[model samples]
Target chain A: MANSIPAPRAEGLHYLGLRDDIARRIATGLLGPGDRLPAERRLQADLGIARGTIREGLFQLEAEGAIYRRDRSGWYVSPPPVVYDPTRWEGFISYVEAQGRRPATETISAELIVADPLLAGVFGRPVGAPLYRIRRRRYVDDRAVLVERIVIDAALAPDLLSHSLDQSLTDILKSVYGLSVARNQVSMRPCALTGEDAAALGVKSGLPGLHVQRLSHDAGGRVIEFDHEYWRHDAVRIDVDIRVR
Target chain B: MANSIPAPRAEGLHYLGLRDDIARRIATGLLGPGDRLPAERRLQADLGIARGTIREGLFQLEAEGAIYRRDRSGWYVSPPPVVYDPTRWEGFISYVEAQGRRPATETISAELIVADPLLAGVFGRPVGAPLYRIRRRRYVDDRAVLVERIVIDAALAPDLLSHSLDQSLTDILKSVYGLSVARNQVSMRPCALTGEDAAALGVKSGLPGLHVQRLSHDAGGRVIEFDHEYWRHDAVRIDVDIRVR
Candidate 1:
């Protein structure tokens, strides 16, 4: 690993060189995920580099999602990003467990809400129609990673709110309503965390996150579920394979 | 237009009401994209709210991708996010143009570099193989939005670097090299902006962005292009539709 580090030279590129060195350490498992990096002063003294240069390199690494910083705890290596393939449609639990990580979900709230215009539009129901609204906090290996709000049209399954709300909604739709997700319209954007989402994810407000919304339909082309998910950006990678026809 | 603004009421949801008011203004074209909002003090006075309340509303708008703030400049309504569909494989120009925005590209650098082991592994070639390296800055309606670094296997197209690189490489491969992209393996993650990427996109370093990479294979199953794209997270929305079989 020592041989892998480039010889320090050229003042302008020192930060980039240092970034590559730290990246190599992460790749070689010398620095594992959630492991705190040596303090800035320690790194500066050990590498004989200026503190500013070290910070610059660390900033580059942060931008690359290789590490993350807490407000006062300095920096830690980021967890291995969870691979998300929307085409699979197995939901969060299956995906996390497939990655060899334990998955858990907490039902924050489940209640009946009058459908708003957005909900009415998605579910093709009249405004003020009754609907089941479920809010959940999802975890991967005990780390709260996502907060989701799911709305289900009560006409499809009138007793949905009475059942377990912490499990996969897809599974519930299949078993309870005899409806399987036939297609999904998934869209994603990056945004700062709102106060509510930031609190749920236990991150600072205004931190960047990925906001994903999925409107799923059943075999009869009826909308089954509309879900909004806020994910900590550092913890997930979305993968897709496209075949050009 | 005044009727469109919701009445300011409720103790805890004042900021949310303010957010909705501003959002309606943007929707009605009263405040277009890139149009700056009033100063914090001015907004506080105009809305009869505390400075903290005004800040909270602006932060909510930012989190929703409805607005963005510069370092010294006050907030501005964000442009409608550019919709990106990787499955279309229409390349950047077509996608941007389809969204009714002007698409432009600047060739930052084009040269030949010796492929390292990583590049060699992707291209199934030996290390030190000659590769065409091209870096480009992309723009939407004159706003620089993305920076891309693409490496093409030069052995497949000996004279690749001699032509223009300001257009889509997918087109170039088909027209100049008689090779068309057959498939793509695309992965995306939320990341902060690296220094070089930040300078190109005119954003602060370590601000959130989306990092996407594509490894494209030709009709013969040979890797043709390895491309890395760093996009300002606020400027684009990724959409994918999947049909379950």
Candidate 2:
């Protein structure tokens, strides 16, 4: 792999060629996910490229999501961004695991709460209806990527708080309650992280993120779950295939 | 509308109620796309809410993608984010129009360029293949929202530069060259705008944006279009519904 790496081209577009060389290293698995790149000064010494050119190439790669900077930390190859498909019935754990990444969910809290007026309006249920509120943070490659708050119709799954709340909630819904997700109404928007969410994701408050809300229904079309998800913008790419029904 | 709006709640979470009020205005069409809100001082006076409270509410709405703040230009209601469905054969103009928004395209440049090694590998063609390069900026509601650079095989469309490049390239390919898009391979990631792109989109360089690259194949499975799109992060949302194939 080292022998095949090309030398930088002429001065005018040396950064482009340098970018290709680094991208090749990433594509060939020579630089795996979470592997930190050498410092800019060190890389400059090794490649015999000017610091400016090296910085430009690194900036381009970061913009392309091929790598990311962890604040004061150095640059590291980015994990493949998770592809979220709303139309599939496959649970999140199954699909994320299918991508050859370790997927883990940590329950932050789970408790029963009466629906607020806003929640009632969203769920179309009467105010004061009992709802099971769950907050969990999901991780990929040991990095926290997603924080979700879910509210379930407590009547449908009684004593839900007593059951294990880790792993895939969709799977638990099926095995414990005989419910399957029939469809999901998902909405996505770009947002900045709130202070609490920023702390959870290890980023400063007001850093841009992605906000995704999913309202999933059961096979009988009963509203089963309402989920609000906040994701680090750099950690995922969204893909959807729209076919004629 | 005034009577329907609920007054702010107690002192502690006053911003929450104000945010709900502003969100309701957006949802009810009281504040249409591109409609600018009152200045912070005026809003504070009208709502009898504190200035800090008003600012917090506005901040929340911006994070929710319901509105946006233009640098030095004040706040405005955001147009509904376009829903791009790659599976449908509809051209960019039609789907955006179907959502009741006017779509316009401005051609920035068109020329013939020899394919570089990267382009040759991506298109599965030999190097030096003549490719038609077209650059365009797209608008909705007269606001620049997307900038795209397309590279197409020039051998398939002779004299392509002579045709109007201000509309959907897919439509032009179908009508002028009898080439129809069969399917697309689309990938999206969060990106910060480049200096050139930032100048075009009227945003600061390094502002987070959505980077979408698409490879579209013709009916006979020949790759016809390679489109790279950059969009302002606040102006658009990405949603894709996946169904079992």
Candidate 3:
């Protein structure tokens, strides 16, 4: 069997060269965001490289967040990721727009439910207390980037669910409910995307994702809201500047 | 050919149950960190479930950071991840020890190298300027969890490479070089582990990893060190606290 198997091709350098070539095109804006790359066969014919070598190069670019493969579809150039600053109180729309990307939000579901044990602990509420659960998907440059699940004290805003849920929750709480966000506690880790979140972000299940959990506090330091956000691994970068002194 | 395939087993609920069972055990300390799980054959016999179902459950647990599989080895419980607060001026050893885990470091390589274009831009040094490059692997509970590559201006820290390179670079700079870290600019995103980083962490290549880049500035507001860290996705969580007022 060993003798029958073909010798592996020496495509290491070829694949690296292909990767750099594509990367340079992206950096120069010749391959804009969401622009599809040449098909594998086309790439092989154009560059005179093996199909496997082209695939290796594409995978490397995907790992570097330069391009992504859609299931059953070809590769497309990835948009530049937005920077997330946890210390800043700016909403997603503000920061994304500041970076010259269009931002939009869609409300998937909004309802009032009894607090679960986990939510109760996080919100310092009774387990049976009523809370508003809102699920929304956010987009940057028309690409779904993250899914956010937010829970707020229903009593704090009686008619919150009746209003538009697509807007920023921070603004809603401040302008409509007279509740200002004074502090935020955030924790983040990387994990595999769940099936539901993956569908929301148009990615494959089990792909790597960034999970961010936050607790928002009122002026008196009372926990007012809790949120869980699942972001496409390549869609956002967490930036934190610290002054040690 | 389609009919030749066997009907898929209804193992979804079973696998989830298995995942919950194992998670509960880990939470209760019945299965401690680094403890090898029962063999798959044993689990199949004990649970009376198909091998595929057991594997699915294991994969889910791994995604949740509860357990991991060593290549060619059985599954093992994962340690609780350590929390990293960029705002705090704490070394890895101090923080890992504070979390009740043993921390160790191994100097992989230390040398003087001419700054490349990327390093020159990051360090504000002229191209080809000499800089000290240090690569080290960090461990928690005897498990390699992160690899760090650090570049420092050679002129500022003369004979720095002569001392031990396995200890905390922050402490060394503070005590020996009279430089205190006063500011840090940190950026992090999820990425696929490269071959070199995966080998250093004793994992398979292409596994999900967390890539962190940091620029450390001293009290004089000069960039003193630029560091790149590749961490096991399951090994650490980033936390940030902000006061909006």
Could you say which candidate leads in DockQ?
3
* Candidate 3 wrongly placed segments (more than 4 Å): A1-32, A37-75, B1-32, B37-66
The lowest-lDDT stretch of 10 consecutive residues in candidate 1 chain A is: A1-10
Q: After superposition, how far is residue A140 of candidate 2 from its true place, in Å?
A: 1.7
TM-score of 2: 0.69
lDDT by residue for model 1 (A1-245), tens: 12333566454466777887888999999999889999888887777777877887886786577887776778889888789988677989999999998899999999999988978888989999999898999988777888999888888888887788788888888887798888888999897776688988877665678889998998789998889999888889999887766
Q: What TM-score would every model get versus the actual structure?
A: 0.79, 0.69, 0.82
Candidate 3 has a TM-score of 0.82
State the lDDT of candidate 2 residue by residue for B151-223, as single tens digits. 9999888888898899777777889999887767777777777668887887645556788888888767688
Residue lDDT tens for model 1, B1-245: 12332477454477777887888899999999889999999977776787877787876676567887776767877777799987776899998998899999999999999999999999999999999999999998877788999999999889887788888878878887898888888899988786688888877566578899999997788999999999988789999987777
In TM-score terms, which candidate is top? 3
Pick the lDDT winner. 3
Residue-wise lDDT of candidate 3 within B1-245, one digit each (tens)?
11221222244466766777787888898999889999988878777777877787786777667787788888999888989887777789999999888999999999999989988888788999989999999999888999999999997898999999888888989899998889999999887776689888888655677999999998888889898999988999998887764
Chain B of candidate 2 versus the native chain B: what TM-score? Answer: 0.79
**Candidate that beats the other on lDDT, 2 or 3, i.e. the better one:** 3
Q: How far in Å is the alpha carbon of B236 misplaced in model 1? A: 0.6
- Listed for every candidate in order, the interface RMSD values in angstroms are 2.7, 4.0, 2.4
